[model samples]
Target: MAEQQRLLGGRYLLKEKVGTGGMATVFRAQDQVLNRAVAVKIMLPQYAGDPTFAARFKQEAQAAAALQSPYIVGVYDWGKDGDTYYIVMELLHGTDLKSGVRSHGALDPKKVAQIGSQICGALSIAHKHEIIHRDIKPQNIMVQPDGNIKVMDFGIARAKNSHLTQDNNVLGTAHYVSPEQTRGQELGPTSDIYSLGVVMYECATGRVPFDGDDAISVALKQVNELPVPPSQINANVDGDLERIILKCMEKDPANRFQTADELRQVLNSYLAGRAVDVPEPTRVIAGMAGAGGTEAMRMGDKTQTMVRPTAPGDTASNPVIRPNNQINTSSYDNEKHGMGKGKIAAIAIAIVAFVAIAIFAVSGFLNGGDQKSVPNLLGMGQEAAVASIKSSGFEPGNVNQSYNDQYSEGQVCEQTPDGGKTAAAGSKIDIVISKGPKPIDQVEVPDLSNASDLDEAKKIIENAGLTVGSTTQEANDADEGKIVDQSPKAGEKVDKGSKVDIVVSSGPETDSVPGVVGKTESDATNTLSNAGFSVNVESGGTSDTYAKGYVMKQSPTGTAKKGSTVTIYISEGKDTSSDEVDVDSLGLTGMTAEDAEEAIANAGLKYDPRQQSSSSVEVGNVIKYSPGGKQPAGTVIILYISTGPSE
Candidate 1:
């Protein structure tokens, strides 16, 4: 339903719808408070009333808020007004990792490792917090234009300390779900690692590790089927890299990398061109959990957002509870609240009289107006305190941060009133937390198409809240220093501390060589130059025996090694003529053959060099002038001086 398009809490203005999910519709918005663009996710009417889903959604965004990494998306706000429940998140400006994989097809092995390593890094942070992301798929990951990978979507997951249900049979996306998820078994950090391995396989081969006619079929394969090695489909995939990917797809969760950190280290070694430690496959035993008494879950009234506690932190580990105050219980009922103010007000006034006179009293009655008690905000950050305080019955006062010795920085160190203390309605509460405030955003870096440039890639990673790790290189046509690969495989969801590997390209190689005989001179020179050959031209002989300018001969007919010089003989046209012959050598008509020979010799003409019989000259020299063939000047004219004979 379209309502007023007013700013959300006078901070973010909803602009346009961007996407839709199982329970929420996402919109693009302008954050008026931060003066930045942001994403706003609103719960659909269908899911808004679902207390379970709503709580999980809120928890997801809130939990994500505690992480700070370049490989995760940031959460800004989450709240409800009337039937509208919405969340504000960071707006990304680049294509998601799935987009990169689709556009580039299967990536090279080096590149897959580059991206996979980063994902492992991001997962480490969440693993450290005991948070297991049940859903780890390509669509949930992002690849920034600057070559960084960022993982997204943390709702419907659970933290170790959370009391959420683990008995439900909600399998993650069919393609990336681990075998345990399909079997409805207890999942751990390894579940996410397994899913990430599937993603890496997809990136390297351009296809997910498993596919079937339906979710069941796909899930069955995850549990029982072995995937073909990535290199079998993509020729560029390296053998060792393929092994790492297969290790990730082990049917048993225990066989897979136990933690994100474990995966990161192995991927690290792979990117470094070193051997990696492959984890043993996980083994499964059905019905491993013994039947025991479970903590009772109390269903609170619709008006109360808080659920009954399932026994506070296991005291053994939490010996240092803030002794000041902590109200772990504040149950509320609905029927009495529906009655008019008269009946409840009378009861509240009577209860108020019980307090000491020095303290101010609130007139609001037992109409259930004072059901919620403010949680002790000491040692909490201003933001955390504001959230806690506002959720309770009190307004958050001007929050100021200060240094504290007992508590960490930005933690709620102290509050105005202790927990369980009765206060007037709407009283502002002051709180201070430790100054060691941790960063709240974890943005997965974007998929960099290739080695764009080490520095450019680094900038993108840094912008995503990630740090750079080792870099590798090989030959490529790309510009020098351009990044050609990354780990995390683009779009693998992760938190902070993910180390992204960068692979750049060094240009092509150069050389020179020989071979030229059946080949022409141009062909020869070209060959030489190609093989790093040099050239020089020269004249051969006056015979012009070979065609002019043709390579009469090269110093070396073949084997023109690099830096070798070979001169070639070139034709310089005809070099002889018949102009010097004396045609008037008239010896007495046939006086004597000897005299005729002497006369022909005087004509600058020589006897036929190659012998042949001639009928005209009558055994003597003077043959009738029959200059049938005309040649250039200084030509040797054989006058058939009688001595010419057949060869």
Candidate 2:
């Protein structure tokens, strides 16, 4: 049967293979139960049988499913059918970031920052959950049609508390792995930030920061080499963006942005046209193998022996035999020599002594006849130290460089054999050169003014290579729970791992608004105003319980912010339903139009004068009026006036 027709877990019907990776193959499939299309990732048969890989695969599904964000691909389901293990995820329609970058060269600096900000948002959520995305290469980022990105493939992400031995070997793509990851060191959110830095670098330069013929070579570079500034590769890259990217790629985790959110803030600030405060990128001292060379080997907790490949006509590949140390006298027969056993023993001893003396004389001649004291090369420059060793009758063996706090760079920090110690002439003396004191990692204090809450401020402070010193709450105009102040303020240069103190706002001061339901309007206003609240008065129509001009209702009857407005309603007295108007008082029959209007105005009723042709009454006179009965004040009164006789 064709692969597309095959069904897994009796629910996911495989359609077509969409992509393939080192550990699994992704297929666009239909989810029968949900009746929707999804991307199903099936573990390759080779890895599916391995218990460790299987467990990690399951973990990927669980971890990705737990994270819900627009920038993160959603995981729906995962299961095993027979020997096949598959995971179903939201199907996306966009090319991977790697493919896009390859098709189109380096992107605009602003575009790169925007993409980075989105990715950081996704990482911020994951890091908060204690999960580190071991792999963060362009291949795992999908650039959607709308220009937003969704991070995919949490296959190698390891939770902080995970016991899986999956990290026995480096897990991420070598070109983008962090230095600590290359050395198999413990990883945290910073490790992921390092990888993100590489991604942004690649996005800005159209190439990876490090590359070689093989993964090991690339991995070694990640640990030892400093990346060439992105601006060099792409001059369009601005200084601010380049520094942000390089900061992410710092060799030391302490030197890199401590948290994804911290990096995200910087990127967002750049995008928002705000000034960014990123320091210059760190430069790591070249390792023993020097920069950009594969000769250096990195060994982590596990011991590794690197064997050089044999070259043509290499003598080291061949084995050699050495003669036994003991003198052999099997060829000499005492009986044939016609000597007694005692005599033969003396002869043998004499021969052995003569040979020993001859050997000693030859060794003495080869070693310049005598022993000499090794020179005191300590504190001497490397070149001077080597020269001194030669002049002092000693040969310089191996010269190695190490970080020494007590010595300056290029000075000899230590030497084998003390200056007074005697060694045979021509013996090799080893020396260690100083590379200077290890550079103290420095980190900039992050601006905490934008922090929304104390917890967020703490994360920002800790992520910026500082510790939260203490937190105090103060009443202020700033919103409650917001960070209002900080110590050793942002933009200060401090040693990495320093402490920072912060202050949190408890919101504005407030006072109780006194109840004014039964008080007069003037008294109610005074009561509210004296309590530090501004008063606003409104009419409360006809309240029988409260007398006229008295407060009937009030808003915010309890505690309220000081200087805030308080609304009070004044009663308009009891209802006048019992009052009525007499019908005869209006008097409109046979009256003039002007006279009728005056009568309506006197009674507090509105006048509505209408014209009609009247033959029985005088012209321009009021002929009749309708509905002459009790009416409320402001009610319209309609009167028919004579418009002379109708034509």
Candidate 3:
């Protein structure tokens, strides 16, 4: 994952891989320009070469970036860097609901309701824009530390008005896929509700409602089987929650919650301990059924809505069996029961001759025919692509519009019967044109009054798609550095990237207390008083190292309100040493050496005696003491006695 550390889009510096999914790997990256951490989902290398994958990747960005909700992961930016496609999003610091459920068994009833409500809120926003999150499961829901939920991964989401052709492969996990999705039919908001029901089922029961040995078996179960009531698996599950789950999982979309807002209202009623309005399920059977007309039933819900194909006796939902190009002749053979053996042989020989003639005609057509490969028209202008298709002996079919961020407006982003595929002359090829980047909604300013500091306010503004503008200082009594007021007041809607100016509290009209720790007491007092602060002096006691009468310390050194008191501590000079002796009046001329030693010791001084020849005093007697006055307690005193006139 060395590529994870590379700078993408010239701004996002990926740090490491956070997760890997089927189509992309998510990396925790740093937005160097904004100086914030974000999650960057990078498309896998295998999908880089695929134009369809590229289109889907861009579609994800367009769908998610247009939606603004607290419960949805915010998409900041998206673009292509060289061969890699990446989407930058808000970095979440919690585990997904699937992991949370696995680590800790079933969740509490109230908590499940709350989480479901938040998810509903997010889905409500997407649904309002006609976007349907085709895949909704616990794996795509993040449970934050503060108990908030964030729904993620709108990669497969498509708008209700989107004209993109549906693919044969299912887009969601089998256990959570709705009946329509399992049958590869058109999807709507109800499909997401169905998947959400599966999520709640797992949350309440600590297990998925449907599981099997293989994906196909699980998918088949999703299409045909009924789920067990959550209360049966976990007796603690209340009837209200169970009803909500069952209603959402109803076989018929009409029987389920019609809109996300309706589901949210139901969840809110449950949370508020009020009676919920649950609709009675109707019995509607689909093409697939149990033996002998047995009804697929579940506790407290007894309805089935069977989605039928175009014709009767069509079991197209059976994943194991598929319709083949070769026509079946069994029905025709069954009608010939009464025919004679010779007649049957003659008929078989005629069929063989007819097949041979058809093969011969096809061979001649292939040997010399007007056929050509469909040229790649993607990235070309719509008019140009249509011209190219016609010039290549092919007819241009219907043109559809889809939102794509990578391709410019009116450019051909996708074409059916893709490039290089062999098509017969004059065949119609459909194309999808780009509508350019999706429109993003205006951002509302978040309340910044609770911001603890400037940095926090800046972060809040930036996260809301606004920038921190010029800051003004105000005097607020409560918090010194908190935000006092903001321009374009909180809750006011402004264009994305608009500047929001803020006023910060400097705390009661304050000024920075001047620094005067080493100045004399008078000088410090003068400086403090001049800066609009009242000055007070305190004796901080003597210091052996500091000179007398200098300011040694101060209180409120950084800042204080005007006229607030500033306390300066003045030094009282060096402390006296208790062992020092004052010997200015001591007499040593008549004292003998022993007496002098005793006197010095009594006075806290060291004595050293020297003998000298002298007529005025006897030998070995103290005649003089040198350099002894106000010395430390360990001062040494030298006593000299005269030694009889000797040089």
Candidate 4:
């Protein structure tokens, strides 16, 4: 039973189990530092008790760790605190490929190829490391809703040339196992390639290459059966791809593509809108030689020799049968052996010179001249540090710039392999450059009121790095074009791409033009401006009909659109005068009067100071006249005392 109160790993705070199976249990755990979701798979204690089982399980996780492909689930870390061995992997957001197939019945060829190509790409990385993902089946493939496929459950995977999986058990889903893998024989990249082919065939046909009523029966078909043509099940499958799948599912391992890349390349070609034709493998060795009367067994130890080191060097690199004493070899067996000691022994005086020459050839490196550790240059600048890394036999990768409030500009902020971690010395070192702290941002609008004027407020809002939805009108007491509402309300933190909505004013209260027949141009303009409208003034000659500066006419009179202009005709106060009015004099004065009038023809003024009054001298002007104040050119000072200057 799983521990209810506590989990195996002290680091991961397990909430509840997300999934469980025969070999392991998957739990939803919170990664403390990264603060990201991860799936932790813990091996059952019964399996962990067996050394071989435990080793193979760890190998499965390690092999997956070495592979760097997006299609493969990312293995973050693996460890064993007690009897619990667990691996942390990316938590996916989709159902397994099995569920997808069950839901859709069968996938189209293009869709099969699209997912298959990515699967092959992932397997290629593992194959390059001489590792085989022994368990390859639809149940182990995750098909996300976005249509991307992720290969999962590398827990049963085994590295080639390793003795871990020799535990002698049928270690994979029986329906999809390769022929050689089913027989527990020495497997290689071709093993995975064959399995991938079986998966592709199943994806296209909705059936495995070989299936039976029982596990043993299915295992038999893997060794002896030929898969049915995919086109027979799914007519949409391309004939070319069907042929490729058959070649991949060949019962004989030797008759399969030697590498997953080969399978991937053919599928890639199909996806690229090109025809693909994969040639059959030339070699096809029959059933496994496992205890089957094969003469391949070694007598004892492929090539064995007694373990004894040369003594401290004597003198000559190689001398006749005298163990060199240049270095003490006796104590070496009690300690750790290394390339340095082997190289120093190469110069010893040995019995034969030929062996010494071979030893000299191997001195530069213990493992084929490979570096073991990245150099440390933490405090150095970019130019010098990159130069130093290159000199140390490692490649520089990804010079990323990040904000560093403390570090100087162009200074290295961080590096991969950190400080003391021993990475392959020739491997790449990814470093982060300091870009200082992020720039201080300007204020952006969050919650905007519909009452705000949108067009008028656009400048203020945009200058603050905010987003606004399309302008709309609402029955608001406030002016139009002002902010109404916003998403991600104000003071709510957002990086960018936030949108806000607002409303704007529609103009002043509109009424049918109030009869302005008696109002002046000034009054009309003020009425329009105050009412949120504008006015235009036009003047025309009067027929002695109306007063000057009064309203003449308006378009759609008294019903003008709010904020629209109104044209008004104004009068100049002109009229014809009667009763002894001086017409000729007033004509030159540019003024017309009615009733009683006084006028100046040009360059003079006249005055009329009476209505129905009797005048003595010159009744038109001198009778009742004012001096220099009327429209006439000349005027006589008319006194009621018989044309006197003054009374």
Which candidate ranks first by lDDT, i.e. highest? 2
Residue 524 CA displacement from its true place in model 2, Å: 51
Model 2 agreement with the true structure over 361-477: per-residue lDDT tens digits = 676667675877678887899899989999998899998999987778999888888775668888999999999888768788899989888888999987787777545456788
Task: Write model 4 residue lDDT over 1-647, tens digit each, in one string.
Answer: 44534544666666578888768888888776667778888888789898877887788788888876667898988899777888888888889988888888788887787677778877887777877787888888998776778898877777656776465466788888887778878777777777788888888988776766999988876775445567656767755777778778776666666677777767666654446766532222243321221111112233111111222331122222422332222223324656655656665646357675565456535556564456675556899879978987788988888886545677776788775445565689988877755654545454455334555566555656765443334333344344544444567654454434444444334566655666777887786668666677777556366677676555447565566677767776655432233433423221223222422323333434443333333333333334323333244433221222332
Clash count per candidate = 66, 0, 16, 51
**TM-score against native, each model:** 0.45, 0.46, 0.47, 0.43
Order of the predicted models by TM-score, top scorer first: 3, 2, 1, 4
Error of 2 at 264 (Å): 0.4
Q: What is the C-alpha lDDT of each candidate?
A: 0.66, 0.82, 0.80, 0.64
Q: Which ten contiguous residues of candidate 4 have the minimum total lDDT?
A: 289-298
Candidate 3 regions exceeding 4 Å error are 280-647
Error of 2 at 99 (Å): 0.9
Off by over 4 Å in 1: 1-4, 279-647
